[model samples]
Each structure stands twice: as structure tokens, then as C-alpha cells.
Target: MTTLGNMKVHEITRDYGIDGLSITERNIPSLSARQVLVRLDAVSLNYRDLLIIKGIGRWRPPAGRVPLSDGVGTIVETGSEVQQLTLNDRVAGLFFPNWKEGAVTTEKTHDPLGGPTRDGVLQEYVMFEEDQVVKVPSYLTPAEAATLPCAALTAWNALIEKGKIHPGKTVLIQGTGGVALFAAQFSLISGAQVILLSSSDEKLERARELGISQLINYKKTVNWEKAVLDMTGGKGVDHIVEIVGGNNVDRSISALAPNGLISQIGVIDGLKGEIEISKLMPKEGMVQGVQVGSREMFLRMNQAITLTQLHPVVHKIYPLSAIKEALTELEQGNHYGKICISAERNQ
Candidate 1:
């Protein structure tokens, strides 16, 4: 097996802000039985990383924690008892490693990577249990594979696995970020109509390039809900990818068709939200919060990706040294797709 003597890790300081982020050195850890070592190639940023870095609410972590969730890399070494995974395998760690399959439980959601609960894969090397990581679609680049763990999988769990949406369904997609784009692509494959909402006409035009023609610039159209209803013949949409949380949720409910499902997966507006019960009750609308997904779900998503050759939209790739700049870009929110951090020297 090859050896990495020491590796650089981005860590959080007591300040818990961008200023608190720093680079540090640590010796490579030894592997135990049933464990394998991955030389992480890239890590993709999500809005959740910002929440954790800024110490928002329950996302606050102790000083010296690594903060990142989505990563993809090649296995470099395997422990004696590690049978399922072998060297040179390309894999990404599960967001919720303990939850392999089945429904959500408090215990399953209790601890997640890149948070206060456990250290994330911001470093060059990460060790995982044999089953904690899953192979990704071979057709995707490392950066694209890195985007799957959270955003992409959350989209799949919401619209496909849980929503069970099919052809002829009208899906209202919010924003143009990672989750939104993934939802849009998945909706296209399922033959569902997508009415994407964005404040910028430029981003909406970009979505149109992806073959999603129905678009609305919320900045110009103050009440895009009416547009959604109008496009659906006053019946409202069948599904809503509610990436904008908080009071906007009520707006989503207003645009829901009878028995429609709205997947609450983002907190761009705010963490706290209130819905109009009267509007939802009459429509029989349902709001389901998606917490990523299990390893089993990841496997299934990979299969679909491989079959369709659907690539995750990647806006830009920054080297590890520019993590702060990447995070700042994410805060500015102009990017149309996922922002990624690559550990490769050439990047």
C-alpha cells in the first residue's frame, strides 16, 4: 500500500466564521480492521457548509473541527478485515453512514458528517468503515461525483424515491443551485414538466439551455405563484422542489395542486418557516423534509445516473487553498451549479 506521511486539513477555530478557518497539518492515521483509507480528490460545497462554518443554531461545532460533507476519492489502502472495498476503488462517503436503508429515525439523523457531531472530509485523507462509502458512476469526473452525497441525493429522495412522481407531473423547481439543478435534470429524465423560479433572468435562461423551457424570473414577476397556476391550467403544480424555505413555504402551498407534494430541502430564505394551514388543508398538499438519504438510496441514484449519463452541473472547481474564496462565492450566490474544492495539485 502507498503511504501519505502527513496531510493538510482545513479546520474550524473558536471564532466559527470565515476568519476562524485555517489550514493545519496532521499525521496520517492508521487503519483498523474493517476500515479503508481514501485519498479524497475533491469536496463539493453546499449551503449547509455555510451554516456550519458560521455556527448557526444547532450546527455550531467545537473548535478544531473539519467542515465539509460531500467528497469523492480513490481508496489507497485497506485494513486486514476490509473485504467489501479494495484499493483503487472510487467512492464517496455517506452523509449519514449509520443509516444504510429504510425510513428516517431520530437515531439515523442524530449524527452527520461536516457538523458539530463528527469531523468532515475537508482533509486529503479520510478513513471509513467498509460499508460507509459507495462507488459512484464511472462516467462522472471526481468533482461531479463529489456533488452527490448531499444536494443531488436529497433531490432524488424527494422527487423520485419519496415523491414517486411520474410523467405528466408538473414540478415547480425553486432556485438554480445544486439541488435545484439536480431536481430539474431528474425531472427531465422522468418526463415531468419543470417551471423553474429564479430571481435572475440570466440563470433562468441557463436553465432553459438544459431543455427546461418553462421559466419565471421572480424578480420581474412579483407573484410567480400565479404564473405557476396559469401554466398548469389553474390546477397548480403536482410537485414542488421547495429550495426556498421560511415564509416562501406558504407561497409553495398556494401553488400546490390538490394532493401535491412539496419537498422541503433548503433554507436559503431562513431556517424557521410557517405554512398556511388553511391553503394546504383544502388542497391536501403535503410538505416533506428530505434529510439526504441512506447508502442504499445512493446506490440506486448511481444506477440511474449511469443509465442516463446525467452529469451533475458543476460551476467551478477551486483548489484547497482557495476554500475561503469558494465559500465567499457561495455566499454571493451567483453560481448556477455546485462549487467544488479539488485536492489535485494541477487544479
Candidate 2:
């Protein structure tokens, strides 16, 4: 392996049926044409990274590499033909390095930051293409900016791109994780009413303080879909950010108004379950799959964030050496925002 100065990485790796990744060292990756070497400032954890570490679903990367989907870093070196990035530029890599446009799909979304596809940024240094990096907002810290690529972009894509959630529209966000919180904020910023659902009443109370119009404690209100209907005067919400797939889809579909949209993003509870298509037929509603957004969509989302002065909620951060613990905390789902990792400390 070729060394580009000094480099070390703390990443999650899984082989075969084994789980719980470990850290390892390798020669620093060299930059290719139109690529840049990035010195990682911080890396945020997404549920996708957790899925990859657990070797679940379709997120598995290639064999023998660090695992992660998104990270923020400063450009240290650039390839000869790379005109888009420069040294010291504050930027975050995209969810799909090669995906530049259009709706994301299985073939296009095959390669992500961490997992088996490519090396993740949980390490001290990583290499990326010029286009794969999106500039961070001046107001946000690297840790905060790091959360944008996967979770925020997914929410943005779900609302702005697919659901077209607009002013006067009503949107329902499930849970308190990065995506749901962003959905709530985006809805508020777009002049729409937001209903946040959570198992924890305490977190729901905090969301209320943030101006969330309504909070549904799903644990207390198991049939929360009916509550949504009541809140909307029996019209149902215009859009629902569906994080819990499987059995929950039926409820989400039931909560949609006429021509309503359901941005299907996750399956935290479990993916294997049935949905009643007839529930959607009468309303003529739509259930769209939301992968993270494109680079162009990311730029648009950045502009929206800037215009609204929106900030990503960061619950806690850990040093790079404590990646495992950070991941454990994320899996426990107690945080109201994102879990981050500081890369430089692992050296």
C-alpha cells in the first residue's frame, strides 16, 4: 500500500456471518484523476451504516474495507484534473460517490461510503471524487455538517423531491432520529404543519418546544393513525415520513389523505410484513421510495438550509477510537439527533 504521509483508520468491518467491526491500519489512499484526498474532520453515524455493520439488507459494501456512508472532511490534496475541490475546503462526501443525478436505484446506489463497496471516512483520511463532495454550510460545524449527506438528504428528498411537501401541507414524521428530526424542521421551514411520532414522551415534549404542531406518543397511542386523522379533521396528513416499515406501512397508508404521499425511507422495526394496497386505492395516494438525494438535490437542500438557517441537531460525539461505543449508543436510539465521530483523535 502507498502511504500519503501518515494515515490510520478506525472503521467497522464484518466478514461472512460475523458481526461487530474492528479497526485496522492501511497505507493512505492515493488520489486519482479528478479526485481529492480528504483529511476527515468528523463522521456522523446513519442507520444505514449500522445496517452495514450488522450486515443487514442491501447495504453491504465490498470485501476488506472500512464501512460508512457519509462523512465531512477538509481537502488535503487533489488530482490533476480535479477542478472542483481545493486544499482546506470544508466538504462532505455524498452517500453514493458515483451517483450524480436522477432518482437513486439499486444499481446506482450500489456503492456507498462505508461497508463493502468502498473505504469509509471513519478513518483519519480517505479519497473521494471532486463531484462526490458537497460544500458544508458556513454556520455548521463539521460534526453537524457530517449529518447532512445521508439522513438530512434523505429527508429533504422525501419531502421536497418526492412528496413535494409545501406550505399549508401537513406532514407526519416518525421517530426522533436524524431523518425524522430533519423532516420536522424542513416541514416547519417550508410553512407546513408537522406531527412528530415517538415512543418517548420526553423527546416528543422537546419536539413540541421546537414548534412541532403535534406529538404522538406511539407507545401510549398504539393506533396513532386515527389520531392523525382526527388532528387533520378526518382528512389525514398530506404526507407521512415512513421510517418504520413492515406492519407499520398499513397504518401509514391508512393515515394518508386523498392523493397523499408516503415517503418510505426505513424499516427500523423490521422490513418483512404485508401492506393492504386497497387502503391506498380509494384515496389514490402514493407511496414512494426515498433513497438519499442527488448531488444537485444536495446543493438545493444546502440552499434551503441556508435560507432557513436550519441546524442539524447533534446529540453527542465520540472520539474515533470509541466508534464502537458510538455505534452502540446509536443502535439504542435514545438520542434526539445524530451521533458523530471525531477522526483525528484516533491517530
Candidate 3:
């Protein structure tokens, strides 16, 4: 196995100036008895990673390597106790970093890789517990599967697990971020009608080509909630993937039909705020927070992905050296979907 050390990573020094990210060489991580060492082929950035860089997320790495929660790689070595995985297994890191199976808890969610507390996958090599890694589908390359750990799993949990949406149900996905985009694709593959909302009509139009039944340009229609209501002929959507959390909560709640579920997946709109819960009371609407997903969820998502050959929509790719530029593009919201970093290309 390659003992990768003195590797450069995008270190976030401060919150205000993203340019504060400096490339620094650090030691390659070592594997535990139950761990596997992977040479990461690709990594994808998520909105949560941005929040951590911006100093808004719950936790932050005190020192050491910069953090990234999701990446895909080939295992180069397996620990003595690791039986399920072997060298050369194409795998993605678990979202929780530590949580392996069963139910999720505050303890399980405490330290996510690439979040505040854990060092992320931005480095060339990473060590993972064999149980915390899930093999990617054979249909997906490293770059495509790299986007799955966060966006795909969250979308799956939101629509299928929390919302319990079926074929005939109408699903509404807000924003064109990675999660929403994945939700749109997953909804379509499930034979559900997907209404995609985005500020840019051009992006919405692009989603149309991917089996999106309805598109709402929220910028053009200021009251997009009314448009959502109008589309369902006042019945509203059966499932709403709510990415922007704050004041938009009531609107998402309002746009749901009776007993309709809202997957509160993110706080991209406003992090600290209050929502009017009374509106949801009338419809008995349920809003469940989705913090990515579990390993089991990833397995389920992969099965669905392989069955449909559903690949993630990658908007742009950046070589590893241009990570800062790629992150800047993401911060500016220039890309429509996931931004991938090719590690081997730059290596």
C-alpha cells in the first residue's frame, strides 16, 4: 500500500476570504485494524462543505487537514480485521464518517468527515473503517459516484424514506443544487412527476430534458408557492424537497397536500431562523431533517441507480490543483449540479 504523506490540501484558514485556503502538505492517514486505505480518485463538494469553510457549520476541524465528507476511491490495502472489502474495491466514504449501521443518533452524526470535526476526503489518501464504506455501482466512474454520498443519499432519504412517495405522487424539488437535482432525477426514475424550481429559467429548462414534468422559474414567478398550488390544481404537491430552510418553510408547508411530507434537507436559505408551524398543522404536514444518509440508504440508492443506470449530473470538473477555483465557482453558484475534482488527473 502507498503511504501517502506530504499531500497538499485546501486548508480553510478563515471564513470571509475563501482565498485564505492555502495548499499545505500533510501526512497520509493510517489504517486501523478494521480500516481500509483508499487512494481517492475523485471528490465532490457539497453545500455543507461550503458552510464549514464559511464558519457557519456546527463543527470545524481544530487543526490538521481540511475536511471533505465525500469521495470515491480504490482500496489499496485492507486491515487484518476487514473481511468485506479487499484491495481495488471501488467505494465511497460514509456520510456520517463513523456511523455504520442501524439508526442514526446525535452521537453518530457528531463527527462527519469534511464537516467541522473530521478531516475530509480532499487529500490524496484516506483511511476508512471497512464498515463505513459502501461500494459504488459498477456503472458509475469515480467522478460520478463521488457525488453520491451526500447529494444522492439525501435525495433518496428525502423522497423515498421520509416522504414515502410512490409512482403517482407529485414531487417538488426546490433549487438546482446537487440535492435538488438528484431528487429530480430520482423522482423521475421512480415514475413520479417532478416539478423543479430554480431561479434560472435556463437551468429549469435543462432539467426538462431529464424527464422533469414541470418547471417553475421562481425568479419570474415571485410567488412560486402559488405556482406550485396552481400546478396541482390547488391540491399541492405530495412531496416537497425543501432545501432553503427559514421563511420558506411555511411556503413549503403550504405547498403540500394533506399529510404531504416535506424533506427539510438543508439550510441554504437561512441558517438561524424560525418557521410558522401552524400552517403545517392544518394539513398534518411532516418535515423531517435529512443529514445526507446512512450506509444502508446508500446501498438502496445504488440498487436504484444501477437498475435505471441513473448517473449524477455533473456540471463541471476541476483538476485537483484547481480546487480553489472550483470551490469559488461553487460559492458563486455558477454550476447547475455537482462539481467534481479529479485527483488522479492532477496527481
Candidate 4:
């Protein structure tokens, strides 16, 4: 185990922007009676991080806030009252610390990590209440494990928890970003066929290498909904991981089979638009907005990942010092999977 010492942390010191993020040195935090200190190895980027950085959404952080939700680390110290966690245990922080299990509630959703509410894990070391962390899968690298708490968990909640994807079902995944790719991987693990849509043929080809043969170039096929219907023999898909918001919702509804599920995970397209209620009414389709997930769901997903040896697709890794560059890469939206930040010096 590495020796613990003073830590360096990135804080949003100025107005909302990548430039506002500044790294500062601070003393290692004191452990509370129920808190455990962890040495973060890697942290993964999410679209939500970008939104928080830009102050684009409701969850904007105050100045000097640490800014990332998902990270994997090793426990270096534990308080006297901490019984569930021990030194050297590998774990990741939960996105929602209070919501350990069960259905989502207003109170549980209020204090998510990495935003305006609570400080996130974008530091070399962090402290968490013993119940706020989960063990990482043994087979995963820190980078892979870091990707699980947000993007991967969101996909798991949307597909496995809500969509109930299974054999013979067709899942429509939009874009080749983190959540979409995770959804595709989880769907394949559940024996479902995946039809991945991307603007770039190059990106789609890369996805094909991951066993997704059914590809739709949305740029080539302007009416991609028609293409989806054609591919399903006009029956449409069983589930749509709807990342694009706005009028894309209408198209997603159009591309669903009878009683299909649409897991609305992102709002890249825009926030508000006319929903074609007349179109959505006949299919009896269901649309559910996905927040990341509960800690219980994260534990269940980790068990499956460990059992299947499912690896997260990390497109690129940047040093913690290059966080601005990493956020730029994420904003460009060209990556095929999760963009990660490694705090490991050797990496």
C-alpha cells in the first residue's frame, strides 16, 4: 500500500468553465468516526461533469468545488467506528451516498456527489462514510472501475432495472459515448441484439468490432427512425437508450415496438421540445428518465461485471493535470467510450 500524505485536489475556483478548475494542495482530511480515507487511483469523466463545469444545468457547484463523481481507490485509513471497510480495500464512491437501496425519493436525489451539493472525488485522496463506497470488481483496473459509478450504472439502471432487456430483444443505442456503449455491452451480456446509431461510419465500424453488427449512420440516413423500423421489419426495437433529447424523443418513440421502453439518459439535443403525444399514444411505449442509480443497483451491476469479467471501454486516459484537455475531448464527442483521468503517477 502507498503511504498517505497531504493531497492535491482540483477545485472550481472561478466562474464555470474548464479554465476555472485549478489544482491546489491541501492537508489530508481528518477521518470522522464513521469515515474512511481512500487514495484515489483514477476518476472517470461524464457528460454531467461537463454540464456542472459549464453551469448549464440545475446542479451547478459553488466556487472551489471538486468536480467528478466516479472514481476508484484503495482505503488507506479507517476511523475507529468503521467496521465494514478495512485498509487496502479497493472501492469506488457511490454517486448518491444516502440512497443505499430501494426506489428513488426526492430527499435521496438532492445530495449527489461532484456537483453543487457535495464535494466529488477529483482529488488524490477522499473520505467517505463506510456505507458510501462499494468494492470494485477484482478483474478491473482502477480506470475501468472508475467508469462504473455513473455512466455504467445509469445504463444498468435503464436497461436491466427498467427495460428488462433479455434474449431476442433488440436494443437501440444512440451514439458511441460511455453510457450508450455500456448499455450495448450490458444488452449483449443479456443476449439482446444491439443496433447502434452514430453520425460517423468510422465510429460505427469500431462499434462493429465490439460485436455490434447492426449499425445505422444517422448522418447518411437522415430519417434514422425509418431505418430503425426497416431493420426491425417495421416492428421497431424493444428498447431505445435515448440519449438525444428534444424532438429526438418523438423519433425515439417512432422507432419503438409495441410496449417498448425508452430510457432517457441525456439531453444533448436540447431540453424542451414538442412530444408527439399522438404518435406515442398508440404504441403504448414507456419513457423513463434515468438518474445514475442507487448504491444497491451499483453493487448488483458490479457482481454481474465480476462474474462476466465485463470490461469497460475506456477510449482514452489523461493525467489529472490534463483535466481541461480531457473535458475538451468529451465536449467534442468523438470518443468511442469513457474518458478517464488517472491519478496514478506511474500511468
The candidate that wins on TM-score is 1
Q: Which residue window of length 10 is worst by lDDT in model 1?
A: 1-10
Clashing pairs in 3: 59-116, 60-116, 61-116, 67-114, 67-120, 68-114, 68-120
Clashing pairs in 4: none
Which of the numbered candidates is closest to the native, going by highest lDDT?
Answer: 1
Per-candidate TM-scores read 0.98, 0.94, 0.94, 0.97
Cα shift from native, residue 208, model 4 (Å) = 0.8
Kindly list the per-residue Cα lDDT of model 2 for residues 105-203, writing each as its tens digit. 677677766756677777788777789888889889888989999999999999988777778899999999999998888888888999889999899
Task: Flag regions of model 3 displaced more than 4 Å.
Answer: 1-6, 14-16, 57-59, 345-347
Over 1-347, each residue of candidate 4 has an lDDT whose tens digit, in order, gives 22466788888875778888888898888888899999999999999898888877686778888899999999989998988889999999999988899999988888998979888999888999999999999889889999999999999999999888999999999999999999999999999999999999999998998899999999999999999999999999999999998889999999999999999888888888678888777989899999889999999999999899999999999988788999999998889899999895654
Instruction: Give the Cα lDDT of each candidate.
Output: 0.92, 0.83, 0.83, 0.91
Better of 2 and 4 by TM-score: 4
Q: Which stretch of 10 consecutive residues in model 4 shows the poorest summed lDDT?
A: 1-10
Q: What value of lDDT does candidate 3 attain over all alpha carbons?
A: 0.83
TM-score of 2: 0.94
Q: Is candidate 1 or candidate 4 better by TM-score?
A: 1
Instruction: Report the poorest 10 consecutive residues by lDDT, candidate 3.
Output: 56-65
Comparison by TM-score, 3 against 4, better one: 4
Candidate achieving higher lDDT, 1 or 3: 1
Ranking by lDDT: 1, 4, 2, 3
RMSD per candidate (Å) reads 1.4, 2.2, 1.9, 1.9
- Runs with alpha carbons beyond 4 Å of true place in candidate 1: 1-3
- Candidate 3 local lDDT, 225-278, one digit each (tens): 899999999999989898888778878887898888888877877865576888
Candidate 1, residue 233: lDDT: 91
